[model samples]
Target: MAIHIIDEANRCLNCKKPKCMEGCPVHTPVPHIIQLFKEHQVMDAGRELFENNPMSLICSIVCNHEMQCAGNCVLGKKGSPVHFSSIETYISDMYLDRMKVKTAEQKKQNVAVIGAGPARMTVAVILAQNGYQVTIFEQQDKIGGIKQYGIPEFRLPKTILSRYQKKLLELGIRIRPNTAIGTTLTIEDLLRDGYASVFVGTGVWKARNLGIPGECLANVHFGIDYLANPSAYSLGEKVAVIGMGNAAMDVARTALRNGAHQVTMYARGRRIAASSHEMAYAELDGAEFVFGKAIERITEKGPVFKTSIMDENNRVTGYEEGEEQTEADSTIIAISQGPRNRLIRTTVGLEGSDKGLLIVDENHMTTRKGIFAAGDVVTGSKTVVHAVEAAKKAAEAMMRYMEKEGA
Candidate 1:
């Protein structure tokens, strides 16, 4: 593994104008990190990675390299791109344990972080490193929000998240597990208790329903809920997954792994929504994909899909006449998700979009003055790297706001 990583690192041309960095959502310094790795400055490479994006290791493992860094590589137009992900994983994983830095002088001001997802974790780390007393309020029993609950262990090992928890604690960030901010302790409550600034990174978890008949059936499940705990539900041999997004691919593959012999995915349009890489993995796992099927409703047998009429552009123009129901033991919906409104319903002056997403300004400050937000709650569901980018800006803004207010 080390030899392969070194070989990939050596392949980097270290472009004067790196397209790989430009393609990255958080603009990770790909060439510079590669240069550092080649120079034997491994720790420095990891430090640069973490400083630019706190969840560097996780992103390196999970981010769609074909669509981002690797895809944009100049060499990839002809040959395989330099696998920066492997090099990053090698450096970041090693540096995470040995990471120790002297923080600024401790301050009396406190900061409240709601949710322990990538965005909130970044905020908490930055706040703690800057001397503010940071406390994270996670609704779950542990941290890593989506990283812990949403992603399957096969893709990203749960042990990595456990290591992150240790690192966060070592940074002097206090974690309050199973304590939801909006339920008993409101955002107002945190402010009343003298929290200088509050950051809400509670990600989107509410599954968007298809609003069709038999959706509430016992045999049917939402993708997010199922991925959170696949062992809890017993999907039989014949499993049907609706939607062709990445989450749908995950559901199909996970179902196949958990004793489901026949797993099929139904797409509404002619083209699928999942990335080619994820789709290939799902296909390689013996999952079948059926496109041009617009779901009308679900039944006891399975999802009843109507033939989707497509235009010249392969867009779903409409649904055709007949409907067909495929036999399946269970059905899972992987359409998408929206933000939960627990905080919005409880907190006055907090504004949200029609889709129930929190409204945030350029600096990630919400409608409420001191309350800042980022991640899926603010920008809908996005990659971890995008959340990290937003969190960095929000953390800086929070520091400025607290300092100006003399909190």
Candidate 2:
């Protein structure tokens, strides 16, 4: 059963400014939605939320609410603020089954949405509802890009993603799975055929490597490779994870659950890059952390690190003389991610950053006309909420472009 709505709804306070909304990346209407839930307008509340984010429940689960919406609550100044995201999530999960999304009767224009990730999914949902015939093209056989591949089952199960997929199909959005944009079909092919606009949300799947010795050892794995295919290989007992972010923590916890006896994480900086809650959970999960150590080299036996302090400039300072070695059968690097430019290189006139991130104007339009890009592909690795915000902005811009250049 869902939590009691009355107690939480009554605590909203419904301020005129609503700093919760202001702090939100997608600007979710917390106060107004709470007001609707308070009045027993259950379906109406969900609809109002979908008006902004189609994936409200998923966001509620993954989002760091204590840092964003709940952080800015006025009542938090005096006491504990209303758990807005949690309340919204409970109400949404309850009402989603009862509510049916009403899409446009007529589907006229066609828009090609590349990658079935969060950004593109948001774009497809918004465009399809507005009478644009949206078709999604995913390189992988399955949908839900990072949500399906990177996020663990404990965090977000595949069953929840399937529900979102069903809604998109019902909204008149078509999809072509196992079809890559560059290898199978190029963006020009879609434009030449009938698609009025092309939106690229293909995120970074390539993981960065630690340019050190013995990197080609047998059990080495990139963070994405390990997460994307859990059954690919046995991580083995005594695993070493490199980095200090959410991905690193997730990898450590995942390895621990997968029968790895001990998972230890190493970071160059003393500060934890991931959310404090996640780090706490990792610690509880029996994962060890060694900070202020830089990996000197990765030998077949394990990784050798040099103890040091990271300066304000991120340079190695206070370098210790001796080397510290951690014995491990496997090493998982979760350092960073760079954009894959295979598709962008094939599509002429689409400019990108030196880092290979797709370059876009204020309107989310790429260098090439009629082409737009968003998500991690456009801005490197960022939050899902930031990607959704960019995609929505792109959707609005496409709507204007569609009108100006009639399909």
Candidate 3:
């Protein structure tokens, strides 16, 4: 692995106008980081990466490089792109353990981060680094939110998140795991308790239903709930997966791993919603795909799919007259998810969009003053890099807000 990374690093042209950086959501200084690696300054490269995006290591593993950084590499037009993801993982994994986190002079002001997902985790780190007292409230027993529950373990190991937990603790950030903010402790309660600013990054956890008949049947399961704990389900050898997004791919692959012999995914249109890399891996993992099949409803036996006719652009134009029900032991829905309304319902002055997502301004401050938001709650479910970028901006805005208020 070291030799491969070195070879890839050497292949970099070190462009003055690096397209890779532009393609990156967080605008990672790809050329400079690679130059640092080439010059045996691996720690410096890692520090720069972590400073720019606190979730650099996690993003290196989970970010859609095929659509972002590596996809925009100039070499990719002719051949394979310089796989910066591998190099980044190498530097970050090394630096995470050894690098010393320095904080500003200790401040008395406190900040509350609602949710321990990618966005709030970034906020906590940045605020803690600036010497502000920070506390994270997570609904789960552990952190990582979607990184822990939504994404499958084969793609991103849970141990990396565990290491990040230790790092956050070292930064003097307090974590209140399994404590949901909306139920007993409201946002209003936090503000009253001397929290200068509150950041809400509670991700989209509500599983979207098909609304069709037989959805409540025992044989049917939602993707979000299943990925959170695949071991809990007893999906037999023949598992029928609904939807074709990245999460659908994960479900198919995970089902295969958990003793499902035949895993097939159904897509509404000819084109799938998942990234090519993920789709390729799912195929490599022996998951089958059937396109142009719109699920009408799920039955106790399996999902009933209607034959969808597509236009030239692969859009679903119409569906055939009848539907066909396939045989499967279980049906899993992976059509995506929406944010829950618990926080907004419980908190006064806070507003959410029609979709139940938090309403935030340019600075990421929500409708409520001094309460900021980012990540999936604001922009729907997106990549980890986007969450980091959003949280960095929100964290800066939060500091300015606190400073102006004399907190």
Clash counts for all predictions: 0, 0, 0
Greater lDDT among 2 and 3 belongs to 3
Q: Cα-based RMSD of the predictions, in order?
A: 1.0, 1.9, 0.8
As a whole number from 0 to 100, the lDDT of residue 20 in candidate 3 is: 97
At residue 251, what lDDT does model 1 achieve? 91
- Taken over the whole model, the C-alpha lDDT of each candidate is 0.92, 0.86, 0.94
Q: How would you encode candidate 1's per-residue C-alpha lDDT over 1-407 as one tens digit per residue?
A: 99999899889998999999999999999999989998999999999998888899999999989989999999999999998999999999999888876578998889999999999999998988899999999999989999999888899999999999998988899999999989999999999999988999999999999999989998999999999999999999999999998888989999998999999999888787688999999999999989899888898899998998899999888888988989999999999999999999999999999999999998889999899999999989888888998999999999999998984
Off by over 4 Å in 1: none
Q: Which prediction has the highest TM-score against the true structure?
A: 3
* Candidate 2 clashing pairs, residues 3+ apart or interchain: none
Candidate 2 local lDDT, residue 233: 72
lDDT of 1: 0.92
Summarize candidate 2's per-residue lDDT along 1-407 as a digit string, tens digits: 24555777788889999999998899998898988887888788888887788778778877877677888999998998888876788777876665677776655679999999999999999999888999999988878988899888898878878888888888888889999998768998999999989999999998988888877888788898888877777878999999978888889989998899999999886876798878988999999988888899897778899988667866667778899877999999998788788877799898888888988999999999999989999888877788889999999999899888984
lDDT of 2: 0.86
- Model 3, C-alpha of 20: deviation from truth (Å): 0.2
List runs of model 3 lying over 4 Å from the truth.
none
Residues 82-183 of candidate 3 have per-residue lDDT tens digits of 999999999999999998979999898999999999999999999999999999999899999999998999999999999999999999999999899999
Query: Which sections of candidate 2 miss by over 4 Å?
Result: 4-6, 105-107, 310-316
- As a TM-score, model 3 comes out at 0.99
